[model samples]
Target: MTIRDFESHAPIVDEETFALITELEVRKAVRLQYFVSLLGIEADVEDGQDESEASRTRERLASAIREEIRSCDTIGLVTTEPKLYILLVNANLGNVPLIIERIAQLVSRHRRPGDGLGELTLSMGAACFPSSARDRSDLFAQVGSLITEARRDNAERHRYRLPPAES
Candidate 1:
């Protein structure tokens, strides 16, 4: 049987490179592989209130996120409304939650000494490539779904609407 089952997910991804990397499980070879991706910007915290200011804040946060992510992670900056960053993890899905927490913390650490507001918060969604989706488009959509879920979740968890979904 062919070991090329890729699932579908969202918000949107440019998974251009195609590969057939072998996947090994605890005691046997697996027929499925997964790539995890983080979608959207954390919206809970912010330093800028206006468009230009918000853009700059987002740029800084995106840059910071890039530095925090590992070298192997595929990081892509999405040019959407709120400005989103994407992290593609190829190792496995088991580490996804940890990765997300690390990202959240990284953003927190980079936040400037309360220019008035305290910590910086962002909204994010994550999806597993080849597991949540088989094609790039589907993966993007799933990530987007997560982003929607995240916005609502963040709104409730943080108290404010996280930045609007990025382009």
Candidate 2:
């Protein structure tokens, strides 16, 4: 998929290219010879008081994510909102954690001081074709749901944890 448009600082695939890639995935499903994993990433700024700063941080974070993806992998902003999806060709489910860790490391390593309110957390979810899903639409739906769940989990985990009081 080619990103022909820009949403803020993020590269986004046009609807036509997105559909074409979906069709290609469907066709590839017939052989079941290739392994493709769809990784969904959601990033948001914790402190949204400064809209401009938040936008810049999100852009930097997205750029970092794009840098981490392989040449064979296709990254695109599926929505104008804070979300990205990577179509990793020949990717294995077993190695997903490593990939995500790499992404997180890159994001953190490249982040400017105090970007995203000092905590630019990433929520990741992945689904493999012919394994987690049998078709393009199913793959999209499953990964979408997975990312949403992951985001919810992250939020809950960080929602109400007070630091130690001057121990």
Candidate 3:
């Protein structure tokens, strides 16, 4: 089955479509002098599950995120990787942490026992237009850097026997 076959309550767009929408939003933000936040989400399911199971986990996580975001927001799935992108129209950097926390809570609530899904981990990074970046490329680059930082932090926590921070 194609990647798009995965079930999601939220509308999931391809990378190209997402990029176009993001560009439009960025332009609007520039003209209106508002804020736009782009969030990059990466979900990791513990190994041992088959491909189908992994895809299901992703779907569930996406649905949970959808519940936390507004109707104006958008979710994009990268078919080549286990990554999801969220476009928060008019949302600024200050609003990112709260959104992330809500998403995390929703995902946790949706988790089921005996599903063999194991522990699902989400690493998120956010960037806001005009504040975190000057243009689309810079915005994406900033998000990528933040994602890398989040992954590093997760790794450090695991290595040091520290509790994982809520995303």
TM-score of each: 0.61, 0.73, 0.81
lDDT, candidate 3, residue 58? 75
Better of 1 and 2 by lDDT: 2
| lDDT per residue as tens, model 1, 107-153 | 55665675543455555665545555545455556666666666765
**Winner by TM-score between candidate 3 and candidate 2:** 3
lDDT by candidate, in order shown: 0.47, 0.62, 0.72
Best by TM-score: 3
Tens-digit per-residue lDDT, 1-167, candidate 2: 46754444334454457657756865775677877777777666666447666655555565666656665566665444325677777775766778887877786566677443566677677777766677787777777667666666654421211111232
Model 2's TM-score against the true structure:
0.73
Pairing residues by index, what is the TM-score of model 1? Answer: 0.61
Candidates in descending TM-score order:
3, 2, 1
